[model samples]
Target: MTRSQALTLKSLAIEAYQPGQFEKDLTRAEAARRIQMLRDEIALADSF
Candidate 1:
């Protein structure tokens, strides 16, 4: 994965562990889904 993608995934994983720190109410599965969506968005973005 690209540095940006890795960074994004890392950030998401951190949030998944401490979501309340960001005032976000996300479950682990939801956080994982969000990460997948971020990856998909990055893929689509790179297609441009």
Candidate 2:
């Protein structure tokens, strides 16, 4: 993943309350998918 993507993923993980060390071997696409998933989770939780 690019530095920006990694940072965004980390931020989203924290916001979703799922913070942790991520695998370094993740592909860019995988990182993007995870970031979007995290955003969705955070949005869903906030909608409650």
The 0-to-1 C-alpha lDDT of every candidate, in the order given, reads: 0.55, 0.83
Q: Tell me the TM-score of model 1.
A: 0.48
Clashes of 1: 0
- Write out the backbone clash pairs for model 1: none
For model 1, how does the per-residue alpha-carbon lDDT over 1-48 read when each residue is reduced to its tens digit? Answer: 444544556675564453333224555665556678656666666799
Residue-wise lDDT of candidate 2 within 1-48, one digit each (tens)? 999989898888877778763556789999988988888888888999
Which residue runs of candidate 2 sit more than 4 Å off their true CA positions? none
* Candidate achieving the largest TM-score: 2
Give candidate 1's error at residue 21 in angstroms: 14
Candidate 2, residue 26: lDDT: 83
Clashing pairs in 2: none
Q: Which lDDT value does model 2 have at 24?
A: 62
Candidate 2 Cα deviation (angstroms), residue 43: 0.6
